[model samples]
Structure formats: C-alpha cells, structure tokens
Target: MSKIRITKEFSFEMAHALRNYDGPCRNIHGHSYKLFVTIIGEPKQDDADPKNGMLMDFGALKKLVNTEIVDKYDHSVVVYKNDERLPEMQKLFENIIIEAKQPTCENLVSDFASTINTRLPDNLSVFSIKLYETATSYAEWYASDNPTE
Candidate 1:
C-alpha cells in the first residue's frame, strides 16, 4: 500500500529571547506561533477494521499535540535553562518553558519535531515540521532532508 500523509496544525502564543543577541531581540517578546506536523503511515489493509479509512484520527492527533507541546508552551516564556535571564523571568512570570538552547524559529521547529517524534505511536512516523514565528516568517524541518547524519 502507498503511504498516506496526514498533517496537524496548532497555534499558540509564546515569549522568548536570544541569549546574546546584539539587537532588540535580546529582550523578551511573544509571537503567535503556528506549528504544522506531518505524519506518514500505511493505511490499514483489512476493510473490516474500523480505522481502516484513516491514517490516524484527528482527535487523537490533537490530544497528542495538546499534551506534548501546546499545554507546555502556550503563554509561557521560553528560555534556555542556562540563560542569564531565566531566574529574573521566572520571578516576573508564573509560567516558563525551558529549552536547552536559544529559542530561535529554526531551533524551535527542530525541537518541536523531536518532541513530537519521540511521543508518537509506533505505527506513525514524523515526516516534516513547519513552524511560523510570524505571519511572513517560518522555518521547516524534514526528517528525510537531513544529509549531515
């Protein structure tokens, strides 16, 4: 059977800053972020299976993304654990999301992909991720496009 691809899109608001940026991005700011995740799998072969028609239920995908990413990042300040401002930011805000590295769009999309990939069910595989930091700006990551590995 041919592989079927399904994509789920999620939107959330988050604040982040560059660790040592020389310009305005050094200060914390928020973006209405958009995230798209693509998953691929082969459709069920047995016509008797109730789920035979779908790659994965949209509701199931939503629940997974909500628990893994949205609930963790929404309306939070995203800072690297080692960031100098983490303590100050935590003191000022009740919700903070920590990452291992600076929170740039490129880095974020990659992290998003990794997080989702790790939690996905064994039958599904992550194919790509497209994350938008702004209306006109976005970053994309594809599992198959990594040539460095």
Candidate 2:
C-alpha cells in the first residue's frame, strides 16, 4: 500500500542549436547529457508475483529507458524546426532530429519526461525527470510541483 520510487542514471551525447538566440549557443554544439529518470509504484502485494515487493525490475527499467530515449537521441543533432541551420545541417548529418521547440536543457528534459510517461506501464507513474546540460547546469520536473494546470 506504500509508494516507492526508483531512479536510474543515463548519459548520452547530443548536439543542438537554439533558435533565434544571438549568442554562441545559437551555433550547433554538443554535450554529454546526463539524465535521471524516476518512476513510482506500489509494491506488489502477492508474494507469488514475479515482481513482488519491488516497484519494478532494474532490467525492465533499463530496457525502457534505453529504447525510449537513449537509443533514439544519442549521437544525433537536435535542431529546432525554425532553425536556419536545419536545412543545411540535414544534408550533412548521417543522423539528425528536429524538435518543434528550441532544444534547450529544460526543453530537452521535458521532452524526455513526456515521452517516458507514455512508455511506462499503467501501474507506474513518472515521479520526476532531471537533466544535466553541464556539471552545474540542469533542469528538473516533478509531478507534485504542478497542480491545476
């Protein structure tokens, strides 16, 4: 009857350029992005259940995170739809992805969280998502932080 949360750390490399920004960041650049994905669930009550007493198996969590986020975006360039470089970059990269909004650290984390939410099992809920753009700069989203939105 009690809720438990589990988090796993994952890192991937990605390049992105902000749209309409008059700064060095407007140019394409890459970062070794670190992500922490957390999920919440209640321990299974049935002792005979395969996942009894655990929120989720670690292997299951790893597989979900890798397939949903890491494998898709790692080593790919993320460009905003309106970015001027989108056209030129598309022709250059062997792999690239376009986002509807500027791919800032905050936006990237939000995207991960939203996509991760859809991939989770019905019994689990996303508790929080944290993304670190650099050693010091990062963003986080917590389900409890927002209400009546």
Candidate 3:
C-alpha cells in the first residue's frame, strides 16, 4: 500500500502577548487561529479491517485535534511563563496558558507539533502543521525540516 497524507483543519479563538518585544504585538491581542494538521501513513490494507483503504478516519482526526488543541486553547489567553503580569493575569482570566516560550505563531507551531506527535498512534506521524494567525499571515512546521530532532 502507498503512503497517504491526511489533513484536518481546526479553528479556535486565542489571545497572547509577546513579552519584551517592542512591537505592537507586545500587547495582548486575539486571533481567530486556524490550525492545519497533516498526518502521514499507509492506509490499512487488510480486507477484514473496517477502515480498509483509509489512512485514518477523518472523524477520528477531528476528535483528536479538538481534544488536544482546540478545546483547550479556545477562548484562552496565553503568555510567557516569565511574564511579570502572569500572576495578575491569572487572577483576572479563567483560562490562561503560561508557556515557557513566548506565544508567537512560530513557537506555537512547534509547541503544537510536540503535543500532537506524542499523542498520535505509533503508525501515523505528523507530516506538517500550519498555524494561521491571520487571514494572510501564518507559520508552518514540517517534519522534514527538523530531521535531527
């Protein structure tokens, strides 16, 4: 059987601030985040299998991404763990994510890859992830780019 790539797109609302940055993005702002998750694997070829000829069920992929990323990050505010306002922000916001790295789109893609990779089944691998922070702006992470890690 030939390898196939399956992609699922997810969207969520999230706010984040870039700590110690001089740009306007330093202030807390929100984006209708768009996440594209691609999985690479060979389709199940066994005739007896219910999922025969399918690399993975789209519904299963939806559930996996929703549970792991969308459900948690939706309507949440993310900040660097070392941000001085973290303590105060935590008190004011019900959903806060204090990440070790600044919540830039680039970093977020890497973070998401780590998360999805660990949770994916052994036979399926994350081929790439594209996070769109805006209608025209986005960041992409490809497994082929970081062969050493």
Candidate 4:
C-alpha cells in the first residue's frame, strides 16, 4: 500500500503568557500564530477511483480543523493556567475556554494535534504539528509515526 502525506497551514491571533518563567515571556503578550498540520496514511483500498484512494479529503480536513479548533482561538486570548480574568473575559465574549494545562506554543500544538488525531479516522494518522509564534520562532511536536523522524 502506498502512503500519502498532506500539510495545511492556517493562521490566527492569540494572547498568552509563559507560566513560571522569570524572563520577559512571563509578561502577557500576543502573537499572530501560524500553524502547519501534517497528516499521513496509506491510501484507502476499496476505492478504485484515483481521487477516492486518497488518504483523506483536504477540504474535509480543513473544515474539521477550521470548525473545531481554529475558529475557537482566532482573535482570542489564550491564558496560561487559570487567571482571575478568565471569567471576566468569558463574559465579554464566547471565545474563552480554559486549557487543561499551561498555555504555551508547545502545549498548544500538542493539544491541538492530539485532539485532531482522535477525531480522525483510524486509517489517517496525524503526524506533526508546527506552530509559529513569530516569523522567526516556532515549535514542532510529532507523533511516533511521523515519517520525518
């Protein structure tokens, strides 16, 4: 079986702080983030049609991430752990959701990748998530099956 991999990029704005950091990162700040999501898997076996043999539909994948993840954080503030301001912010807008843990680029990528992997079909594997906090800085988290190694 032949395997296929696809990557998609999306961008959104969010605010967060580095928890327990003594440096400048400890201060609240925001970034216009860019995300790259990579999915990989063997082509489906039953579909004789060229298009049908694809591991997954790009449009559907885009829709899934856009609806479930991207839309939730776009233009929103992502805080580290819990802060007293969270409830106040939630009242002002419907966008705030408490993260299970500290909010950092690494955790954000991991969380989003894990959530997406769980929602996808078993045949499709979410290989990696790269989140760019700035044009020069980014973080990447990979699953065990990632071909990039």
- Candidate number of the best lDDT: 3
Q: TM-score for every candidate vs. truth?
A: 0.93, 0.94, 0.97, 0.83
Q: Score residue 87 of candidate 2 by CA lDDT.
A: 87
What local lDDT does model 1 show for residue 91? Answer: 89
- Clashes per candidate (backbone, < 3 Å): 0, 0, 0, 0
Residues 1-149, candidate 4, lDDT per residue (tens digit)? 77788998999888776657778876667899999999989876676676667777788889988987889988776765456566666676555557768887878888889889878898887888899999999989888744443
- Give the range of the ten consecutive residues with the poorest summed lDDT in model 3: 140-149
Which digits, one per residue and each the tens of the lDDT, describe model 1 over residues 1-149?
Answer: 78999998999999998888899989999999999989989876778988777888888889998998899999998887788878888889988888888889999888888888888888887899899999999999998986341
Query: Which parts of model 3 have CA positions greater than 4 angstroms off?
Result: none
Clashing pairs in 1: none
Number of residue pairs clashing in candidate 2, backbone atoms closer than 3 angstroms, sequence gap of 3 or more or interchain: 0
Which candidate comes out best when scored by TM-score? 3
* Model 3 lDDT on a 0 to 1 scale: 0.93
Superposition error at 57 for model 3 (Å)? 0.6
RMSD of each: 1.6, 1.4, 0.9, 3.3
Model 2 CA lDDT for position 129: 93
User: Each candidate's lDDT (Cα)?
Assistant: 0.88, 0.87, 0.93, 0.80
